[model samples]
Target: MDISLKNGYEELGVAWRRGCEFLGTDYAIMGGAMSWVSERHLVAAISNAGGFGVIACGAMTSDLLDAEITATRELTQKPFGVNLITMHPELDQLVNICLSHKVGHVVLAGGVPSKETIRRIKEGGAKAICFAPILALAKKLVRTGADALVIEGMEAGGHVGPVSTSVLAQEILPYITEVPVFVAGGIGRGEAISTYLRMGASGCQVGTRFVCAFESIAHPDFKKSFIRANARDAVTTVQVDPQFPVIPVRALNNEGGKKFIETQHNVIARYRAGEMDLATAQLEIEHFWAGALRRAVIDGDVEFGSVMAGQSVGMVKSEQSTADIIQELVAQAASAFSDHEVIRSNP
Candidate 1:
């Protein structure tokens, strides 16, 4: 390790990092689970590199999730986690799969988690992590037995909340003391991570940066999109009609995104012509990108597929191993402390 890196870790007090103890990782950093991108290879790489990695179980069958967990185990003995959407039809079965694998942690994403779901995760002896978009939700998640909270802001990729990461951190970090709070959204470097930690965040959940990791399975074209993108290029989809609720999805602006707006317009026309009800129209709109992320991620269709990325995509200049990414972030974070002159000077 470089002397500056060692000095950086010392300044942050490695042992005192909030999420490190609970996550059982050397660093409190967590590789955000990206569907179609986060799999056994990437997840294990992150864990082996000393950061917690999470398998994204997006719309997978219980058997598939089981296979993924098992594959990850074969790759690394270090603790990792599985992120399951709460709305999954087989939610409980997925929880069981996690338990069967002796998974250390389970994260519930997409919506508010039910008590039964949280209970199942805990009862199975795995830590329950949930997203807290607001302060009230943060408190509720903690009370519902969630072992920790991930307060993600709207700057995140894919599905996102309306709040910005900085605002969310200020609102939720100050009052939430019962459990560790990890901040996410637009976090592309260690300086931002260190800033959040100083503001009472236990650690950070990062996604955009890892999307282009050498171990990530994202298509080469998708990686190129990230490499070429600037913060301004990542935009959210908008709902054409007010009657239909907009699901703000952050992704690289491309032909697919433009066509999605056209799709919404068509759906709205159907609703107006009395050919479709509001509910059906909304469903049609939502289904526009049913397999778009996979198309972009797996097939390298960057121009017409959902190239989901955060504002931080602008910062990813090249692909590196997961270990190198983690080390770079840690060194950057540690350097923040040194630059602040927080490190004690030798007398």
Candidate 2:
């Protein structure tokens, strides 16, 4: 792969171009934060390797987040960020914890972030990154002071939105120029990253491929599942009852997923029988997977734990170092640039 003419993918849009500058990293690639999977070791390794790393604060208390941030700082002196879910009960305190630690970046995921949350992050001298589910929301997030946006598609692992990456890029990128937009979901290789950057994304966020990283603490069985599975093996949960809201989550199909379907049916039937109210029944359904991810990631219960994974799980063939993964993606992107140049020159 002759990448001499690629020029390090400098053709990406200005917003993402500035996003790299804002992140203070050599590359704009961000290791998407996955619950129970992203921790100090993986986060530090990603940052030290030149791509951005974000600590996933899924259901973590303020004290835990503080300790995680302190530990990550000790591992690598490079810049890294913390990903805080919007629905977190301790949202304010978590933001305050990041502020107290002088964290460089805070990514707000799970839902649209409130303006006050965005303001607090920015006012604390940290960059605020929000998830944009649609073009309108992308523009609105910018208006609310989001420094950058991550447009994640349904093909992503864990909790996901409805749109695909390709369609979201087409719909949101051309219109929203206020901030850099990082495309996520279904991005498996460097070529795809290059394609999104050319389409106006500032960079890309990847999760599934990194789940098996050598630095990742995910259980061996969980990593093995990712390695052995193909894209088709990852499917989103379907809503068994329309009355109860079901936010689709992508994961490797296993015994846990099968049981979750049955569990939902029973819970919905109880609700319909007037034995339980809507909220309590919904909570019962949601709580089914509460501690399940941890079971898969830490306890090696792949058979009955949530093995959250994106479609890109198919490309994760082995457990490599985080540096190797970043280098591979960078090299692939550079090669794609060179290939494009060759075709343009020939034409």
TM-score of each: 0.96, 0.96
Cα RMSD (Å) between model 1 and the true structure? 2.0
What is candidate 1's lDDT per residue for 1-347, written digit by digit as tens? 76665676786765236689999999998889899999999999999999999999999999999999988999999999999999999998999999998898999999999999999889989999999999998898898899999999888999998999999999998999999999999999999998998898889999999988889989899999999999989999987767888889999999999999899988898889999898898898989999999999999998899999999999999999899999899878888876655455542
lDDT of each: 0.91, 0.90
- Report the C-alpha lDDT of model 2 over 2-73, residue by residue, as the tens digit: 354444454432424666897898888999999988999999999999999999999999999999999999
Best candidate, lDDT: 1
Worst 10 residues of 2 by lDDT: 6-15
